[model samples]
Target: MKLIFSIRSYDWIDYAAGLILSESDIYHVMILLKDDDGSMCDCKNFCSQAIYEQRKFDLFNVGKKLGVKKLINLGYDADEIDINKLTSQLQLYLMLSGVNEVYCQYSLPILEILKNICNKLNIKLYFYNIEDRKDEYLMVVGKEIRLSNDIINIKNNLSNLTIGRYTIVVNNETKERFYYIYKE
Candidate 1:
């Protein structure tokens, strides 16, 4: 089974698109929620909190879009960057459920922690850039790409692919100057 570990809600859509293309079972899709800054966050308090209305909507829509309804909310935490708590929770979960692979696109602070966890869990960790959003189809599609699908747009924005511990990158593969994220 493949798992995606996305912390930010904005990143969820891209990961969801990738997960969909990867053909990972929706049953295994879990949102590592509650890297959350508090105990009383916009937890399903959608359309209520103006402070986080947009986030709540995004979280709900993204999960629903990915067919992942279950969430692992680490309830009651004040520290925003609580690496220890996050790692511990993740370890416990992995102890109970062995993982086949995990994909995460994130900045620093959690990188080392995630690497250690993946190593301990003995699972493959794929680290694609935040920009490498929706390109699983591009890897397999023919060169004469002419997609006008309503569900997926062909931004062709993938630049790198990380499998295991290796990062394969594009060095002038395309002449296009800008990368675009497919908007839904």
Candidate 2:
């Protein structure tokens, strides 16, 4: 899946995927050692966290270890977010990718704009409020999507991925209701 995870911060890193793989915490990390003059800053692998850490990296194949094929990070200080810029950039980025689905947090007020952009691109964007579990809908999208089986399938897949820790959401309005598993 071509995915973009809106990361809160790098305090919790998913080193296994070299990017923010989850909205939760993980034990993985990546060290992009660079010269004092910033010569190795490739901007490809270096994501929002990498930039915050003063490092750079290739973000395209970041999720190979986590089952996500094309994952990108849109890191930000939620308290000081520029929603307009974020939305515009997000639309551009999605337009340039091969992504079929999107997982975004309803907490982001720009979700409406993001939804419109996704609609234009014919992409499936699933917005969820994971912070709360009593919502009527697991997702919020266009009317057309709300009436399709695509959303239902996404809900099921997300529930399975999260190990049944999610609710199906009757969606009086309406979301990953996803995480990776590993066996040692």
Candidate 3:
């Protein structure tokens, strides 16, 4: 299965558009790494709280738009960058879930790290960039190509789908807990 693993940001409309327009059977599994610098000052600010809430709300809407099957968050922060922990977690998930293709949105060292991980795990990796958002139908990283249809605005087409929301239940076959779309 294909997995859309995003981090740090909730900009998923472009990814959703690529999948929809291509008619590819790709399941989005957003892995939100909580690397927020939880400073006391930042936490205490009212603006910060409001922005957090807004971000959460936006994430929900984006997930719904993408029909995300699972949203995983690795809680807490580390004092230092623990490559082993990060690699193991990602590898375990990919192995367990049988994910072959990983479309990721991350920056810097993490991007390089993901590349190495995907390479080692024998999985296809696509660097998902919001800047190259709707221009390319398929997420071919580094390729600059305009989408044939200028009239088609992808963001406008994102309508929330109506389906029975399922809680994270253990899959009998895989023995893995899956959280489908959240219920309102």
Candidate 4:
């Protein structure tokens, strides 16, 4: 599966780039919202408890626009950065938004805290690492085959055929194959 980690600062783009590149079904985009102090604030609320609700509302609105499945807070501080505190704060925001997944940018401490919280809340935790290269490719070929009404009639006529795997080919090359395992 593809996963994206959205951080709280643009500076994290480099760090995130080293992990993920380009966007696809498995990997999308990681959005980072920077704090006023140029540090990752997790969401819009960090230090002040009074603004927690407001921050959560703002985050939900932004996340909805971005189509983010989950949101993570990367709290940074000059003196001391508390991963547990940040995780707790983010958990509240996620709960309010009805999001289950929380992510981090290679922060082991933050991941551990998220793990504990997920276990307590019965939410699933996913840690995504950037692969060196994409592994799979899908291709669809159309010109080599043609379908007519006769094929539909044939399919209907085969209603009594025992459910099993069948291979249909125009020539020696296999054009289409299907497995009908559960037909009554």
Worst 10 residues of 1 by lDDT: 159-168
lDDT against true structure, model 3: 0.52
Largest lDDT belongs to which candidate? Answer: 3
Alpha-carbon lDDT, every model: 0.47, 0.39, 0.52, 0.39
lDDT of 4: 0.39
* Pairs of residues clashing in candidate 3: none
lDDT per residue as tens, model 3, 71-180: 56554244555777887887788878888888777466667877887898899887665353334344447533343242144333442321111123245332221121
Compose the digit string of candidate 2's lDDT tens values, residues 1-184.
4353444322112112222233333322211112112112222343434344432232212223344433333544446667678777777877775566665555446667667888999987754334343433332344112223442333233322222121223564213223222110
Candidate 3 stretches greater than 4 Å from native: 35-53, 75-81, 130-139, 142-184
Q: Which of the two candidates, 3 or 4, achieves a greater lDDT against the reference? A: 3
Q: Per-residue CA lDDT of candidate 4, range 1-184, in tens? A: 3334444333223222222222222323333332334111223233443333343444454334334445454445434666566666756744554544433454456567666766777655555333322432111111112224443333333322212112344666553233121111
Clashes of each: 0, 16, 0, 6
Predicted structure 1, TM vs. truth: 0.55
Which of 2 and 3 is ahead in TM-score? 3
> Per-residue CA lDDT of candidate 1, range 1-184, in tens?
5566665434444434544543546434444443322212213332324423444544455555556545443433334556777788777766676666666656565567778888987877665453444453332111122234533442233211100111123683423122244432
Q: What TM-score does model 3 achieve against the real structure?
A: 0.58
Candidate 1 backbone clash number = 0
* Model 1 accuracy (lDDT, Cα): 0.47
